[model samples]
Target chain A: MMDLTQPQWVKHVVFHPFEGFEDLRWKKGGTLKYTAVIIVALFFALIAFDRWCGFQFRPLPDAMFSVVPYIMKSVVYFFAWVLGNWAICTLLDGEGTMKNIAIYSSYALIPYIVEVYIQVFLSHILVRAEGVFFSTVYYVGIIWTVLLLFNAIKAVHQYSFTKTVVAIILTIAAMLVILFLAVLFLSLFQKVYVFFYSLYTEILYRLRV
Target chain B: MKNKSRRLLKQCAAAGLVCLLSFSAVSLPVSADEPYDVYNYNYLGEAVPSQAGYLAERSVSGLDLGTTALNAPSDLFKDKDDFFYLVDSGNNRILKIDSDFTQIVQEYKSFKMEDGSETTLKNPKGVFVSPDTGLMYIADNENARALIVNPDGTVFREITKPASTVYDQQLTFLPQKILCDNAGNVYIVLNNTTKGSAMFNADGEFIGYYGANSVAPTAEVIANHFWNAIASEDEKKYRSRSTPTAFDNFDIDTVKGFIYTSTSSGSTDTDIIKKVNPEGYNLFDYMSGYTWGDLFSTWYSGTSYKTKIVDVDIGDDGSINCLDSTTGRVFQYDKEADLLFIMGATGDQVGAFSQGNVTALETKGENCENIYVLDAGKGTVTVFGQTVFGEIVHEATALYNGGYYEEALGPWLEVLKRDGNYRRAYLGISSAYYNMGRYKESMEYAKKADASARYNRAFERYRSQWLREHLTQLLIGIVLIVIGIRLLKYVIRKQKNKKKHSEPAASGSGT
Candidate 1:
């Protein structure tokens, strides 16, 4: 018998040709895929703005979508959704056709749309005076939670109802584990961030001719 | 050697810096109340009793619970491993039911003696499964002996003791109603016609007998009258009672290592339920008069709430619910965080209780999502699903508003087990695990999350960043230490050179 423990390069190549292809397809999904891409771009944009300009948005931004920015946002969102969908498809099926890929993407987008509506509604009701831009932090939460639930349900359907219930249970459990890690990681980040910032500043000072 | 030292110092400084950055990146649940929620329950009205109490209508058609020829099934138990066991009392056998009560899938005849001869059993009154080993015991009414069945269906031994009493010529004495603690010690409750019950350990060693023909404690001396008020099935109102007699039942609190027997005595106006520890300790006494007027044939069941001493189930945060068998009322004990959520009393046809008697109760699953109720009279087991296990997450979010890292850890871990690749819980679990003193496990789960999303640049970015931060901390710390040391050495050498030059000049002047 083949040594099951050893890594079989030949077998892996033969078995997983489609794996890399799926990732490529996700990256190259046309204009329609721009929604996911735009979402991801907007996410990063928000985070970057928060870090650099300290211009953190909260509540719901009252500004309506302009043609160019809206298109840009759609592209970012398309990439983001593609990334999420690809992550799921690749993880579950290893490889999926673009047609199948779109179908799955739509399934996930249902919850995404719901989450967006929820954030908009909440922003209007709860933090309306603050303007929609101020509620970015809260909106991020709605997006994350709704996506998690939808993904879990989709996962269950792919696996089984039993698996879905079990998945839901395990998701709750994973929360506890992540909480612990976040604490540890957060504390480490604080000390390192300050130290690095100081070190970079000190080097700049000492290196002055 | 100096270069090596410098490298080591830089590594140390880098390590320290990387550690600091990652530490500040994530939020943790550090609040004291980060564990669980506490709610208080108040007294709701009485539980209604069905005139034609719960009967197996679907099976064997029209078999009434009250007047059915078949004996009332007894000994409802869920093994520690969550396997369900029920002693089909009239069948002279034990039925191992699945958690969902899907079928009477497996049956074990416990009445056989060691010799393979069928031991005569009038009734198998009580049953106990060893939590440690799953060994089963049945109290046979006809045989008048407690028979132990090996885990593999063979009769291990029939425990025969002098305390084993047969009912006076009528097969009245229930042979062995047994309860087992975690240590496999068994406490059998034998109903003696002359004396009430004789308690025994697993070794057939008799402990004591209490409350004979006239010695049974009166109902007035107990603590609360939750088991007092009797209600009709429609739950319209309470019925008045002249006198009531209390029946005793036994159960083992495996977690607490206590064997408890609930006892009650009845007077014309008062009804009481007293739960005594196996050591003949009257721990809690229910002596109050009934809130609702009692009926004549009110059957009461006394079970420890999730093995707690209090006749109620308490969440990790101290929420309490006391189940009153008589009134069918589940009282919310805490008024402040009053969560008197009424359930099982839902007026659904299939799920409704024919009688108000809830014989056994247990809180199962990670968050106690389901409550199991065994009504022997009903011949049915009903599960009440909590629509709000998700409520814990919501409430947890509210109290610990910001990323509740500590509180989130418990739920996140559960989520990971449910769905291994779930990222949100994975991210939550990974960070929580690290903070919760489980580093190695955190790595495994985090790696799973990362692996599941390998093609995603965001995950890769975070994962790589984490690794880079780790390595940089090591490298930078070493570099810093090395530079500091070299600077110190150069200064020292310079000072020595200056001293030597000054001394030489002094000598030349003397010459």
Candidate 2:
């Protein structure tokens, strides 16, 4: 049998969510490098979905490309959820480590990445009238990803279903708090920089006098 | 660093001078070489160089006709006899000029009432001549009344504020423009009424308001509704109330008797142009998805400036000419509301308006050969006569709009010969070919025009034709492929059985 502790075991875990994640936890199969690669791939897939989708599905034909928001949405959001869940898990006496949570969460995103690439390819072939078919596939992919995520969290943390639900809600709340602080930090930095720059300008004026 | 800064300043000055020179060059009046610069958007919505449908023939000021200078002429009306009526609002008089605009036929400053008393107009803003009765109707704006007078200057009727309980008594009755139908039912555009124009009977009796503008549902309106649902009565009292926009000007379609109204405000996007039926419902409401005016402002970035339609004129051929005061351009639409042409601009040149509002627009001649635009600021009426290129386009458009697709094909092709970038010509030619049962050619033209809907229709027909032509060959090929696949499978199965038997026998012998 193929070794369950290999990095390639993530594929088996994603396909067989109930059994595969339980085996991954027992075998210590998940790896941080694989998860980081998956996150980067998902980001590229998202950019491709936006730029190369059919005109019928592309809402903003004249939309400009901005990479900063994409990075925030994919990479920063992934880390936020992992860290948030890790903090909540510690209080709840969950068994998962931070690395385990990151690997499991990234593995759960496999379905979404595959779905987006498929959508990008199908968009070129299908017209507006056949949009229902494309949307059904898209929605199924998202639901499958969500189910995988639930199973991953449950198996990695070794928590009951109810505890997993509460843990997810707390993690979402933590994400919001983290986002608020990030915005606050940016604004405070701006104000401080402005204040110091004005002081420098005033000192230069006095020296010139 | 100091030398570099000085160089930068010199470069900036040079650039500014170049900009000023280019602007002045554009502002210079039309010379013989460059008669007029005209353009129109093609099918792809890209502006392309095209012929000016109309050339500025001459500007007729009241002074040129030996009459008092037209002071802020707010309106112009063309009677059935082709006589021009200028509402000299600032002068408080109506100057009637002949079709040639050279001679003043008559000037009516006051009318004789039934009591033999003289009732003079005060800042009259609008004048209309009834084709049915051959009488004149003047909107006495300052006096807040409309006077119906005979051709001989005798007051037939004077309509003042309606005394009905339905009429809001608090609102002032300032009539700015007036028009009459063949049935003699009068419509008066009031200055301050958001409820729409006030209608009156032939005998000067008050009727209810007609065709009020509807408010556009913006985000603020939705938010206000949400707040109002939960707000206390005392809190609601302090909240601002939403009101509909008012119609600025209107004209009657003599043939269909439909009233066309234009609102000139830039703030509201809803009901900028409306065609009102006699039942007081806007016929243009059916066109909910279409936008009237410039899709995007050419001057402003990331902001859409709605067309401020100040005046609308319906031609004999069922074309609607909307005069946009903001851009000082006339957007002409056919009966189906397809834009046919856009002319004029805001500038100091002869073909443009100089800080002057395009107060009124009128079309003359059997085919609407002449277009007259009155500039209130310049106190001049600039006449535009159709060019040869314009004539061809109008001829083609008239035929196409009239549902003569086959007949319009020749003229549309002729238009393409003159200007290959004309998108309308491509669409027209494609439609003509489609109706002529030439789907392939139609698809080519539709593709050129970037009209996907038309291209899809043509493609459907073309695909069916191709299928029909190759149906027999396709059926034969399918049958042959199926037979070949079955034979190959049988042969492969036989070969596999033989190989299995041979392998088993060889293994037994080896053992």
The interface root-mean-square deviation of each model, in the order shown, is: 25.7, 10.0
Show the lowest summed lDDT stretch of 10 residues, model 2 chain B.
Answer: B28-37
As a TM-score, model 2 comes out at 0.71
**TM-scores of all predicted structures:** 0.36, 0.71
| Reference-based lDDT, each prediction | 0.46, 0.84
Q: Report the lDDT of model 1 for residue B250.
A: 54
Q: List the residue pairs that clash in candidate 2.
A: none
lDDT of 1 at B46: 28
Give one digit per residue, the lDDT tens place, for model 2 in B195-309.
8889898888888888899878899988888898899999999987678889989988888888999998777887888999878788888874445666666566875555688
- Candidate 2 share of real interface contacts: 0.00
Per-prediction DockQ comes to: 0.01, 0.09
